[model samples]
Target: MDIVFEELDYCETHMGDLMLRKRSIPSLDGKIIYEVKLGEEFLMSSLFHDAEVALSHLGLDSFGTKQVDVVVGGLGLGYTAQAALEFPNLRSLTVIEGLSEVIGWHKRGLVPLGEKLTQDSRCRLLHGDFFELAQSANLDPEHAGRKFHAILLDIDHTPEHFLHLSHGGFYQPEGLEKMARHLHPGGVFALWSDDKPDEGFCKVLESVFASVEAHLVEFDNPILGGTSSNSVYVAYAQ
Candidate 1:
């Protein structure tokens, strides 16, 4: 029999009723899955992190052989951040997370890859609202007036299906333009969406970015016992 172990660290964020839990499923056997929820809505799960990792792989791949400085918004389970560090030439990585408890999990080595991410000298985890920071001229508050080679985000379900209303603004042209300002020339902006690419959103990105592309990443869903897909939106900064 598989045992499900869960604990709620804390709740009552700006978003409301946030909970972090752990589970072991029959399908996963010995593997433990970490999950986060806002109210009744399931936000992220460790079991379904293929697209999160792919966000870094596809975004960094476009940069080719250059040593890159990267920023990852949302550090859930640290999959995306861990993926970003996989590149050998990665110079520095900044993971900006909204929830302080999530950041603590990594520093305390509570999750499987937590120690790997926290121990890396190249990575820094800061607590803040990713949406607000992304719209500012500086992506990282600690190091103001600095730009990055790539910025990968996995915070929301999609631009249209935002986790919070406050994030809705950043998906638009004006807000995205602000994010673009902090990117080095030819820097990459990649977003992980639970839904397929939105044509209208792509149009919005094209207006601010030099080029834009959408990629569908396929992965197996252990719960559904079938293949599932998500979209990766990449916008290149000039």
Candidate 2:
């Protein structure tokens, strides 16, 4: 297969080091999308569409009926953010991206598809660590008594197949506890994973929230009928 490379950039996430590259392949539905890698490991390919669906599965209602505020942890090609914007009841949408360049790519039109979401009136893009924002959102005095209707995290590959070591904390007991604090009572906490996290994540969710559920999302292609499984875990605060 002949692959055409467009641009390459470096990024360091909590997990470790990653190289973001743009590539073009005729077989890839003739569309060019960014691909992410950690050292030699193939973290994620742009061809997959499950990320957007996982992000959108949070199921938030329009603000007219009930105001909803959302905090999305990773921007990632803007699919998730784009889906979140579909909600009419959304009061505010804050997207926290750890990489400044990723955000820049969206602004400069390199990733033209994501630009509108970043520029939307309801959206605010923050260039910083997602965990820090998670912590601040939970404890900030100014935001006291305020909580997000939905907290959607699509960082790392998945809890079970993490690209970075530090990402493990997000699936741990302490991490889930802190994450739960940021969610409004009855609000949803949705996590996207490349694969199921060996039941440990569910146990952690159970320990922190009143209910936990998992949904399996499978991808099928036209030619080979390619299939990959991704899981969405939803935890609700009592």
Candidate 3:
């Protein structure tokens, strides 16, 4: 089967070059979303349903029956946002994407998978620096004290192997501390990583959160299968 590329968007990041391609075929129900090759490999796509499930699980567990506010760091294919919206208790979902072009792709409906999510009244897509947003959330009195019930981050493959070196701080002790501060006491923080990080990263998480655990997510499809597993790190603020 051949994949037809319908649209292409390019972005030059401090780390390297990145592109998003919208591909489709008659047999598929909707357009397939692909993040163009980064370094030498393609990161992820709409085809991976398990990764999205991992994100949804976190929100469902945290929200319970109360209206929960969520802050999702990356808006990849709107999977996390879509999952957040599924929960009736979700009061608001703020999806912050670092790249402006990525936001455009969603707004233009290039990635049909995320079209409904982008249009949801509860979903707010912000085009800005995620790290900055995270930091600002910690400083603003109105936001700082308001702990988001759940924070889902899918920004990088791993905390250590940041897509951009400047983002390295996010994985460090200070960064985790800042993140913990933003969470309402007992709130949960969930992160998605393409690969597992070193023990040091786990230790950093443990230092801030009362408890920390990693869950491995596996997919069944052959094209989406292999040893390529996504790890979800969950931590609860003390």
Candidate 4:
């Protein structure tokens, strides 16, 4: 028999009830999976990371072997950021996280890939709300009015479901247009969605971008004992 253990941590944020936990699930082979949570919801588990990694590959694939600057909006488990760094042609990667505790986890080496992503020379961890920063004239505090080759986001559940009510605005045409201003010409904007692609959302992107695509990323779900899927929305700047 395998024993399950959980050590919970708490934090306070304007968004809502914030909590993070280290869940250890053991199996017959002594394999274990670590998970992070927010409130009552399961945020990210080490076992299911294919979709997170796919967010990087599918988003950056079109760039080919060219050196490019990138920004990852969320840094859950560091899977997406780590995947972006795997591209040798990637020049720089800046990860903007809403919660300071999440960034501290990587600095403190609490998560598996956190330490490695933090140690990478090409990766820069910044403390800020990604949605707010994306709309700002200066995306990065160090570099004013800077633009990136690619901007990948994995913050909300989907266009219809948002973590905070304020986040809802970012999905609108005006908000998306502001984000586009932070992208270099022909740059890509990618977002990870927990739900299937929404046609309405695609139309909104189409209005603001030169091109748009939604990729269905499938992965094995150990919890459900079946396959699961997520959507990665990629758009190009004009």
Candidate 5:
């Protein structure tokens, strides 16, 4: 039997109430959609992930090296990490997620891309805070002071909006420089934002990176009966 609506999992964390749900909309031909919510805000949905996938392509495609080691901040729905693994030349992918419940969804096969990521020898799911890790030099605990070829971030809503107050520092010039230290020279840093391209954030990127570009990715909005767009900021470290 098809579940019209089901809340798969719900738990309380330091962050807030986190819930994972699966539902089918009869109006949309019973298309099953998986949704994750933290507190009152909807974190991610399986229905709209075009920008999430683009975060990987835009970042990895801009890298100068063929063998790329990548770090993905935020494991929401595993879309960004899964997309990064699709790269043929990707050497390794480390995903840093703040919440353990989110990781549990993947390890327990509650999410669609769970097994695909876990079975892949190249991917590693690490439980930690991305913002805190960004401040530190090493993203991987196994390797101290290791630099990556690319860092793809999808944690906060935008450079100005954040899930936590502490995350706000990562967008600043000093914090950005700290995160840049963990990337190889000419490495890529791409971010996914729900808002349209922001010129202010671009200026911040230009201050730290050799080049910067904001890509507007548009996708169909089935529920809204129109189109919606998201912003992707891709920058290369000098």
Candidate 6:
């Protein structure tokens, strides 16, 4: 098969240069892949999204089968948001994406899950800084002070390794407390991390939430010829 690569879109933002691209790798059976990059860092790829899907399942599963209002911190290929809608009990999903370019990829059908997310009435892709919105009393712009049953975040690589220095505060106790206010009682907050589980961060979550658990999500890494893992942290409000 002929090798194919294309840069779908590119734009500059306050954080850095944001880009969306699609390509097919001959070595990997020429499977088409969608990728997002921020400056030097590769934000997400369609090729490996097991953990993203796991973030939704592990988070919402805590609520049992009750209808849930969910807020996803990052849109990244729409995997997390799309997975959230898979739950029959999910009443609504609000995805907060900091870069409009990322959201445009989905709106323009540049990514695989784009149309699925756009066509679904339950999902709303809102352009805003998640950290900033998380501090607010509401995640949905249309509904002021509206609380949610779950908030699944996949923004930074990890709580310790932030995409931006400003994001560091959100991992702190004060920041977590502010975000917790937006969740309904017994609601859950879940996060995806590229790094291994951090005991210190779990302690911080334990401080604000009634219960906390960190799950290790492992998946096949075809490119690397082995399994890679990500961590998901779930915390329940009192």
Give each model a TM-score.
0.95, 0.83, 0.85, 0.94, 0.97, 0.97
lDDT of 6 by residue, 1-238 (tens): 8888999999998989998898998988999998889999998888889999999999998677688999999998988998999998999999999988788888998888889999999988899999988887766767898999999999999998899998999999999999999999999999999988999999999989999999999999999989999999999999
- Candidate 5 residue-wise lDDT at 41: 96
After the best TM-score superposition of candidate 3, give how far the Cα of residue 32 lies from its true spot, in angstroms: 5.0
**Backbone clash pairs in model 4 (N, Cα, C under 3 Å; residues 3+ apart or in different chains), count:** 0
Give one digit per residue, the lDDT tens place, for model 4 in 110-216.
77787799899999999998888877898897899888999999888898888888898999999999988988898999999998888999999999999999888
Tens-digit lDDT track for model 3 on 95-158? Answer: 8888776788788886765579777899888777777666665522334466677788887878
Model 5 CA deviation exceeding 4 Å by range: 1-3
* lDDT by candidate, in order shown: 0.88, 0.72, 0.74, 0.86, 0.92, 0.92
Error of 5 at 42 (Å): 0.6
Candidate ordering by lDDT (highest first): 5, 6, 1, 4, 3, 2
lDDT accuracy of residue 205 in candidate 3: 89
Per-residue lDDT of model 1, residues 138-186, tens digit only: 7788887999999999998999998888898898899999988888999
Off by over 4 Å in 6: none
Model 3 spans with C-alpha error above 4 angstroms: 1-3, 11-15, 24-33, 38-41, 137-146, 224-227
Best by lDDT: 5
Query: Model 4, 5: alpha-carbon shift in Å?
Result: 1.1
**What is the overall TM-score of model 6 with all chains considered together?**
0.97
Residue 134 Cα positional deviation in candidate 4, in Å, after optimal superposition: 1.1
**Deviation of model 6 at 35, angstroms:** 1.3
Number of clashing pairs per prediction, in order: 0, 3, 1, 0, 0, 0
Give the runs in model 2 whose Cα sits over 4 Å from its true position.
1-3, 8-18, 59-64, 136-146, 222-224
lDDT of 2 by residue, 136-218 (tens): 55432345656788888887777765655656776777877777787777888888887754477788789988888877878
